[model samples]
Target: MARPLSPKLSPSIIAQAALDAVDHDGEFTIQGIAKKLKVSPSSLYNHIDSKADVIELMRGQVMGRMDLSGVDSESADWAGSLRIIALHYRNAYALNPRLLPLVTAYSVRDATTIGMYNLMAQTLRTAGFDSTRQLEIITVIDNFVLGSALDAGAPDNVWAPGEAASPELRAALDAGLGAPDRAQKSFEFGLGLLLEGLAREAEVLG
Candidate 1:
Protein backbone atom coordinates (compact mmCIF):
# COMPACT_ATOMS: atom_id res chain seq x y z
CA MET A 1 0.00 0.00 0.00
CA ALA A 2 1.17 3.57 -0.73
CA ARG A 3 2.31 5.51 2.31
CA PRO A 4 0.52 8.66 3.35
CA LEU A 5 2.23 11.99 2.68
CA SER A 6 4.21 13.81 5.40
CA PRO A 7 2.79 16.91 7.03
CA LYS A 8 6.10 18.02 8.46
CA LEU A 9 7.09 20.54 5.79
CA SER A 10 7.85 24.10 6.93
CA PRO A 11 5.60 26.94 5.78
CA SER A 12 8.49 28.63 3.99
CA ILE A 13 9.32 25.40 2.22
CA ILE A 14 5.70 24.92 1.22
CA ALA A 15 5.44 28.52 0.04
CA GLN A 16 8.59 28.23 -2.04
CA ALA A 17 7.31 24.99 -3.51
CA ALA A 18 4.07 26.68 -4.44
CA LEU A 19 5.97 29.46 -6.23
CA ASP A 20 8.10 26.90 -8.03
CA ALA A 21 5.02 25.03 -9.14
CA VAL A 22 3.45 28.19 -10.50
CA ASP A 23 6.67 29.17 -12.25
CA HIS A 24 7.04 25.77 -13.89
CA ASP A 25 3.40 25.19 -14.83
CA GLY A 26 2.38 28.81 -15.66
CA GLU A 27 -0.64 28.12 -13.50
CA PHE A 28 -1.44 27.34 -9.89
CA THR A 29 -3.85 25.21 -7.93
CA ILE A 30 -3.94 24.08 -4.33
CA GLN A 31 -4.07 20.39 -5.25
CA GLY A 32 -1.17 20.81 -7.66
CA ILE A 33 0.89 22.47 -4.92
CA ALA A 34 0.07 19.73 -2.41
CA LYS A 35 1.06 17.10 -4.96
CA LYS A 36 4.31 18.94 -5.71
CA LEU A 37 5.16 19.04 -2.01
CA LYS A 38 4.10 15.41 -1.47
CA VAL A 39 1.66 16.56 1.18
CA SER A 40 -2.05 16.13 1.60
CA PRO A 41 -4.22 19.11 0.64
CA SER A 42 -5.48 19.28 4.20
CA SER A 43 -1.93 19.31 5.46
CA LEU A 44 -1.28 22.54 3.54
CA TYR A 45 -3.99 24.18 5.60
CA ASN A 46 -1.80 23.68 8.64
CA HIS A 47 0.76 26.03 7.08
CA ILE A 48 -1.38 28.46 5.06
CA ASP A 49 -4.91 29.55 5.64
CA SER A 50 -5.99 29.52 2.00
CA LYS A 51 -4.83 29.84 -1.58
CA ALA A 52 -4.86 33.63 -1.26
CA ASP A 53 -2.60 33.39 1.75
CA VAL A 54 -0.17 31.28 -0.23
CA ILE A 55 -0.22 33.77 -3.08
CA GLU A 56 0.41 36.62 -0.66
CA LEU A 57 3.33 34.74 0.78
CA MET A 58 4.69 34.20 -2.71
CA ARG A 59 4.27 37.92 -3.39
CA GLY A 60 6.33 38.80 -0.32
CA GLN A 61 8.95 36.32 -1.42
CA VAL A 62 9.20 38.06 -4.75
CA MET A 63 9.51 41.46 -3.10
CA GLY A 64 12.13 40.10 -0.76
CA ARG A 65 14.31 39.36 -3.77
CA MET A 66 14.47 43.08 -4.57
CA ASP A 67 17.42 45.12 -3.30
CA LEU A 68 15.58 47.73 -1.30
CA SER A 69 18.66 48.39 0.83
CA GLY A 70 20.28 50.18 -2.08
CA VAL A 71 17.68 52.94 -2.02
CA ASP A 72 19.43 55.66 -0.05
CA SER A 73 17.12 57.72 2.10
CA GLU A 74 19.84 60.27 2.82
CA SER A 75 20.88 60.78 -0.79
CA ALA A 76 20.56 64.38 -1.94
CA ASP A 77 19.15 62.94 -5.16
CA TRP A 78 15.96 61.62 -3.63
CA ALA A 79 14.10 61.93 -6.92
CA GLY A 80 16.81 59.83 -8.51
CA SER A 81 16.38 57.27 -5.76
CA LEU A 82 12.67 57.19 -6.53
CA ARG A 83 13.51 56.55 -10.17
CA ILE A 84 15.79 53.70 -9.16
CA ILE A 85 13.02 52.23 -7.03
CA ALA A 86 10.65 52.40 -9.98
CA LEU A 87 13.15 50.69 -12.22
CA HIS A 88 13.80 48.07 -9.58
CA TYR A 89 10.10 47.33 -9.41
CA ARG A 90 9.93 47.11 -13.20
CA ASN A 91 12.88 44.74 -13.32
CA ALA A 92 11.39 42.60 -10.57
CA TYR A 93 8.14 42.31 -12.51
CA ALA A 94 10.04 41.50 -15.68
CA LEU A 95 11.88 38.67 -13.98
CA ASN A 96 8.71 37.21 -12.48
CA PRO A 97 5.88 38.07 -14.82
CA ARG A 98 3.94 35.13 -13.43
CA LEU A 99 3.90 36.87 -10.04
CA LEU A 100 2.91 40.31 -11.38
CA PRO A 101 -0.80 39.99 -10.67
CA LEU A 102 -0.18 38.78 -7.16
CA VAL A 103 2.35 41.52 -6.40
CA THR A 104 0.15 44.20 -7.85
CA ALA A 105 -2.78 43.25 -5.59
CA TYR A 106 -0.81 42.33 -2.48
CA SER A 107 -2.13 44.19 0.56
CA VAL A 108 -0.07 46.66 2.57
CA ARG A 109 -1.60 45.56 5.87
CA ASP A 110 1.20 43.04 6.00
CA ALA A 111 4.18 44.37 7.96
CA THR A 112 6.63 43.65 5.14
CA THR A 113 4.55 45.47 2.58
CA ILE A 114 3.98 48.46 4.88
CA GLY A 115 7.66 48.57 5.75
CA MET A 116 8.61 48.77 2.09
CA TYR A 117 6.23 51.67 1.46
CA ASN A 118 7.32 53.42 4.64
CA LEU A 119 10.90 53.26 3.51
CA MET A 120 9.93 55.13 0.37
CA ALA A 121 7.87 57.59 2.37
CA GLN A 122 10.76 58.24 4.71
CA THR A 123 13.01 58.90 1.77
CA LEU A 124 10.56 61.46 0.46
CA ARG A 125 10.23 63.05 3.85
CA THR A 126 13.98 63.30 4.11
CA ALA A 127 13.89 65.05 0.76
CA GLY A 128 11.88 67.85 2.40
CA PHE A 129 8.34 66.76 1.64
CA ASP A 130 5.86 67.22 4.49
CA SER A 131 4.05 64.15 5.71
CA THR A 132 0.89 64.86 3.74
CA ARG A 133 2.85 65.71 0.64
CA GLN A 134 5.11 62.72 1.08
CA LEU A 135 2.12 60.41 1.01
CA GLU A 136 0.80 62.09 -2.12
CA ILE A 137 4.15 61.70 -3.82
CA ILE A 138 4.32 58.08 -2.80
CA THR A 139 0.87 57.40 -4.22
CA VAL A 140 1.75 59.09 -7.51
CA ILE A 141 4.99 57.17 -7.81
CA ASP A 142 3.26 53.86 -7.05
CA ASN A 143 0.64 54.44 -9.73
CA PHE A 144 3.25 55.50 -12.23
CA VAL A 145 5.47 52.50 -11.60
CA LEU A 146 2.64 49.96 -11.64
CA GLY A 147 1.02 51.47 -14.73
CA SER A 148 4.33 51.66 -16.56
CA ALA A 149 5.11 48.03 -15.75
CA LEU A 150 1.69 46.91 -16.99
CA ASP A 151 2.17 48.83 -20.23
CA ALA A 152 5.68 47.52 -20.77
CA GLY A 153 4.66 43.92 -20.05
CA ALA A 154 1.73 43.93 -22.45
CA PRO A 155 2.27 42.02 -25.74
CA ASP A 156 3.39 44.31 -28.52
CA ASN A 157 0.75 44.84 -31.20
CA VAL A 158 -1.71 42.96 -29.06
CA TRP A 159 -4.77 43.79 -31.19
CA ALA A 160 -3.25 42.32 -34.36
CA PRO A 161 -0.02 40.49 -33.82
CA GLY A 162 2.19 40.21 -36.95
CA GLU A 163 -0.43 41.94 -39.03
CA ALA A 164 -0.17 45.19 -40.99
CA ALA A 165 -1.65 48.18 -39.28
CA SER A 166 -4.95 49.50 -40.60
CA PRO A 167 -4.59 52.31 -43.10
CA GLU A 168 -5.99 54.87 -40.70
CA LEU A 169 -3.64 53.84 -37.90
CA ARG A 170 -0.73 53.63 -40.31
CA ALA A 171 -1.52 57.08 -41.58
CA ALA A 172 -1.56 58.31 -38.01
CA LEU A 173 1.78 56.64 -37.47
CA ASP A 174 3.26 58.37 -40.50
CA ALA A 175 2.15 61.69 -39.04
CA GLY A 176 3.94 60.80 -35.78
CA LEU A 177 0.61 60.39 -34.02
CA GLY A 178 0.71 56.74 -32.99
CA ALA A 179 1.19 55.42 -29.48
CA PRO A 180 4.16 56.96 -27.71
CA ASP A 181 7.35 54.93 -27.40
CA ARG A 182 6.28 53.16 -24.24
CA ALA A 183 9.35 51.46 -22.90
CA GLN A 184 11.62 54.38 -22.01
CA LYS A 185 10.40 57.51 -23.72
CA SER A 186 6.96 57.36 -22.17
CA PHE A 187 8.32 56.55 -18.73
CA GLU A 188 10.76 59.45 -18.80
CA PHE A 189 8.12 61.77 -20.16
CA GLY A 190 5.67 60.90 -17.40
CA LEU A 191 8.36 61.16 -14.77
CA GLY A 192 9.50 64.54 -15.98
CA LEU A 193 5.95 65.85 -16.05
CA LEU A 194 5.27 64.63 -12.53
CA LEU A 195 8.48 66.14 -11.21
CA GLU A 196 7.74 69.41 -12.92
CA GLY A 197 4.31 69.54 -11.31
CA LEU A 198 5.76 68.75 -7.91
CA ALA A 199 8.43 71.40 -8.28
CA ARG A 200 5.88 74.02 -9.25
CA GLU A 201 3.74 73.08 -6.30
CA ALA A 202 6.72 73.38 -3.98
CA GLU A 203 7.47 76.86 -5.31
CA VAL A 204 3.88 77.94 -4.82
CA LEU A 205 3.77 76.59 -1.29
CA GLY A 206 6.98 78.36 -0.37
Candidate 2:
Protein backbone atom coordinates (compact mmCIF):
# COMPACT_ATOMS: atom_id res chain seq x y z
CA MET A 1 0.00 0.00 0.00
CA ALA A 2 1.21 3.55 -0.72
CA ARG A 3 1.61 5.95 2.17
CA PRO A 4 -0.65 9.03 2.28
CA LEU A 5 1.08 12.13 0.94
CA SER A 6 0.79 14.59 3.79
CA PRO A 7 2.14 18.10 3.35
CA LYS A 8 5.76 17.98 4.42
CA LEU A 9 6.55 20.11 7.45
CA SER A 10 9.46 22.52 7.66
CA PRO A 11 10.42 25.40 9.91
CA SER A 12 8.34 27.86 7.85
CA ILE A 13 5.38 25.53 7.90
CA ILE A 14 5.59 25.19 11.65
CA ALA A 15 5.95 28.93 12.08
CA GLN A 16 2.92 29.64 9.90
CA ALA A 17 0.75 27.19 11.82
CA ALA A 18 1.91 28.62 15.09
CA LEU A 19 1.21 32.13 13.83
CA ASP A 20 -2.36 31.18 12.97
CA ALA A 21 -2.85 29.67 16.41
CA VAL A 22 -1.47 32.70 18.16
CA ASP A 23 -3.47 35.07 15.99
CA HIS A 24 -6.64 33.26 16.88
CA ASP A 25 -6.05 32.52 20.57
CA GLY A 26 -3.33 34.93 21.69
CA GLU A 27 -1.17 31.94 22.63
CA PHE A 28 0.23 28.73 21.18
CA THR A 29 2.19 25.66 22.13
CA ILE A 30 3.87 22.84 20.29
CA GLN A 31 0.90 20.60 21.06
CA GLY A 32 -1.58 23.28 20.07
CA ILE A 33 0.23 23.86 16.78
CA ALA A 34 0.43 20.14 16.11
CA LYS A 35 -3.30 19.85 16.66
CA LYS A 36 -3.88 22.77 14.34
CA LEU A 37 -1.70 21.26 11.65
CA LYS A 38 -3.29 17.84 12.15
CA VAL A 39 0.13 16.46 12.85
CA SER A 40 1.59 14.65 15.81
CA PRO A 41 3.35 16.67 18.50
CA SER A 42 6.48 14.67 17.80
CA SER A 43 6.37 15.85 14.21
CA LEU A 44 6.48 19.48 15.35
CA TYR A 45 9.33 18.71 17.69
CA ASN A 46 11.28 17.40 14.74
CA HIS A 47 11.32 20.88 13.17
CA ILE A 48 11.42 23.28 16.15
CA ASP A 49 13.46 22.78 19.28
CA SER A 50 11.15 24.79 21.52
CA LYS A 51 8.32 27.34 21.62
CA ALA A 52 10.93 30.08 21.45
CA ASP A 53 12.19 28.89 18.09
CA VAL A 54 8.65 28.81 16.76
CA ILE A 55 7.97 32.32 18.03
CA GLU A 56 11.20 33.63 16.51
CA LEU A 57 10.20 32.26 13.16
CA MET A 58 6.80 33.86 13.46
CA ARG A 59 8.46 37.20 14.23
CA GLY A 60 10.55 36.92 11.11
CA GLN A 61 7.48 36.07 9.06
CA VAL A 62 5.81 39.28 10.15
CA MET A 63 8.84 41.55 10.09
CA GLY A 64 9.95 40.16 6.77
CA ARG A 65 6.84 41.64 5.19
CA MET A 66 7.44 45.20 6.37
CA ASP A 67 7.10 47.73 3.52
CA LEU A 68 10.29 49.67 3.88
CA SER A 69 9.68 51.69 0.75
CA GLY A 70 11.48 54.92 1.67
CA VAL A 71 14.05 53.82 4.21
CA ASP A 72 17.57 54.83 3.32
CA SER A 73 20.23 53.39 5.57
CA GLU A 74 22.69 55.88 4.06
CA SER A 75 20.40 58.90 4.01
CA ALA A 76 21.31 61.82 6.26
CA ASP A 77 17.62 62.50 6.88
CA TRP A 78 17.57 60.44 10.03
CA ALA A 79 14.30 61.96 11.22
CA GLY A 80 12.48 61.19 7.99
CA SER A 81 13.94 57.71 8.02
CA LEU A 82 12.57 57.27 11.53
CA ARG A 83 9.07 58.29 10.48
CA ILE A 84 9.11 55.83 7.57
CA ILE A 85 10.39 52.99 9.73
CA ALA A 86 7.96 53.68 12.56
CA LEU A 87 4.97 53.63 10.20
CA HIS A 88 6.03 50.33 8.69
CA TYR A 89 6.89 48.87 12.09
CA ARG A 90 3.52 49.80 13.58
CA ASN A 91 1.66 48.50 10.52
CA ALA A 92 3.50 45.17 10.66
CA TYR A 93 2.56 44.39 14.28
CA ALA A 94 -0.95 45.74 13.80
CA LEU A 95 -1.58 42.75 11.52
CA ASN A 96 -1.18 40.32 14.43
CA PRO A 97 -1.20 42.45 17.52
CA ARG A 98 -1.90 39.39 19.64
CA LEU A 99 1.64 38.23 19.00
CA LEU A 100 3.22 41.46 20.25
CA PRO A 101 3.58 40.33 23.84
CA LEU A 102 5.21 37.07 22.83
CA VAL A 103 7.55 38.84 20.45
CA THR A 104 8.64 41.26 23.18
CA ALA A 105 9.22 38.54 25.80
CA TYR A 106 11.58 36.68 23.52
CA SER A 107 15.05 37.89 22.62
CA VAL A 108 15.23 39.26 19.07
CA ARG A 109 17.92 37.22 17.35
CA ASP A 110 16.17 37.20 14.01
CA ALA A 111 18.12 38.86 11.23
CA THR A 112 15.11 40.34 9.41
CA THR A 113 13.81 42.27 12.41
CA ILE A 114 17.35 43.09 13.47
CA GLY A 115 17.84 44.82 10.14
CA MET A 116 15.31 47.50 11.12
CA TYR A 117 17.00 48.01 14.48
CA ASN A 118 20.40 48.19 12.85
CA LEU A 119 19.19 51.03 10.65
CA MET A 120 17.76 52.91 13.61
CA ALA A 121 20.93 52.44 15.63
CA GLN A 122 23.12 53.49 12.76
CA THR A 123 21.00 56.59 12.13
CA LEU A 124 21.24 57.66 15.75
CA ARG A 125 24.93 56.99 15.97
CA THR A 126 25.50 59.02 12.86
CA ALA A 127 23.57 61.86 14.46
CA GLY A 128 26.09 61.90 17.34
CA PHE A 129 24.38 59.65 19.87
CA ASP A 130 26.64 57.84 22.30
CA SER A 131 26.20 54.10 22.67
CA THR A 132 24.09 54.48 25.82
CA ARG A 133 21.83 57.09 24.23
CA GLN A 134 21.49 54.98 21.16
CA LEU A 135 20.16 52.16 23.32
CA GLU A 136 17.76 54.51 25.09
CA ILE A 137 16.46 55.84 21.76
CA ILE A 138 16.00 52.30 20.58
CA THR A 139 14.06 51.46 23.71
CA VAL A 140 11.86 54.50 23.26
CA ILE A 141 11.04 53.53 19.71
CA ASP A 142 10.35 49.94 20.76
CA ASN A 143 8.04 51.01 23.54
CA PHE A 144 6.14 53.41 21.31
CA VAL A 145 5.79 50.89 18.52
CA LEU A 146 4.61 48.19 20.91
CA GLY A 147 2.14 50.51 22.58
CA SER A 148 0.90 51.60 19.16
CA ALA A 149 0.30 47.96 18.29
CA LEU A 150 -1.67 47.55 21.49
CA ASP A 151 -3.69 50.62 20.66
CA ALA A 152 -4.47 49.22 17.26
CA GLY A 153 -5.66 46.01 18.84
CA ALA A 154 -7.95 47.83 21.21
CA PRO A 155 -11.62 47.84 20.36
CA ASP A 156 -13.19 50.98 19.03
CA ASN A 157 -14.31 53.28 21.84
CA VAL A 158 -11.75 51.84 24.22
CA TRP A 159 -12.69 54.43 26.83
CA ALA A 160 -16.16 54.92 28.26
CA PRO A 161 -16.94 57.47 30.92
CA GLY A 162 -19.69 56.97 33.46
CA GLU A 163 -21.76 59.52 35.46
CA ALA A 164 -18.95 59.73 37.97
CA ALA A 165 -16.48 60.66 35.26
CA SER A 166 -15.34 64.27 35.13
CA PRO A 167 -16.84 66.57 32.53
CA GLU A 168 -13.30 67.19 31.31
CA LEU A 169 -12.76 63.50 30.80
CA ARG A 170 -16.12 63.05 29.11
CA ALA A 171 -15.46 65.98 26.82
CA ALA A 172 -12.03 64.64 25.95
CA LEU A 173 -13.50 61.27 25.07
CA ASP A 174 -16.17 62.95 22.96
CA ALA A 175 -13.55 64.69 20.87
CA GLY A 176 -11.98 61.39 19.95
CA LEU A 177 -14.96 59.07 20.29
CA GLY A 178 -15.72 57.33 17.02
CA ALA A 179 -13.18 59.38 15.21
CA PRO A 180 -12.01 57.82 11.94
CA ASP A 181 -8.79 55.88 12.12
CA ARG A 182 -8.27 56.97 15.72
CA ALA A 183 -5.50 54.51 16.41
CA GLN A 184 -3.67 55.42 13.23
CA LYS A 185 -4.02 59.16 13.83
CA SER A 186 -2.82 58.75 17.40
CA PHE A 187 0.17 56.70 16.32
CA GLU A 188 1.21 59.26 13.73
CA PHE A 189 0.83 62.09 16.19
CA GLY A 190 2.71 60.22 18.89
CA LEU A 191 5.49 59.25 16.54
CA GLY A 192 6.06 62.84 15.57
CA LEU A 193 6.07 63.85 19.24
CA LEU A 194 8.62 61.19 20.11
CA LEU A 195 10.85 62.02 17.16
CA GLU A 196 10.81 65.73 17.88
CA GLY A 197 11.47 65.23 21.57
CA LEU A 198 14.26 62.77 20.86
CA ALA A 199 15.83 65.09 18.32
CA ARG A 200 15.91 67.87 20.89
CA GLU A 201 17.38 65.56 23.53
CA ALA A 202 20.01 64.35 21.12
CA GLU A 203 21.18 67.89 20.59
CA VAL A 204 21.06 68.65 24.29
CA LEU A 205 22.98 65.53 25.18
CA GLY A 206 25.38 65.66 22.29
Which of the numbered candidates is closest to the native, going by highest lDDT?
2
TM-score of each: 0.72, 0.92
Candidate 1 residue 85 C-alpha distance from true site, Å: 0.9
Error of 1 at 148 (Å): 1.9
On TM-score, the candidate that comes out on top is 2
lDDT of 1 by residue, 1-206 (tens): 98774657776677688778766776578888888778788888887887778877776666666687788887877777777777776666555566666655655544555667877887777677898888889889878876776667656553442357787876655654335554656777888788777766756654
Clashes of 2: 0
The window of 10 residues in a row where model 1 has the poorest summed lDDT is: 154-163
Candidate 2's residue-wise lDDT over 98-172, tens digit each? 899899899998888988899888888767788998899889988999899888888887886579779898988
Worst 10 residues of 2 by lDDT: 68-77
Clashes of 1: 0
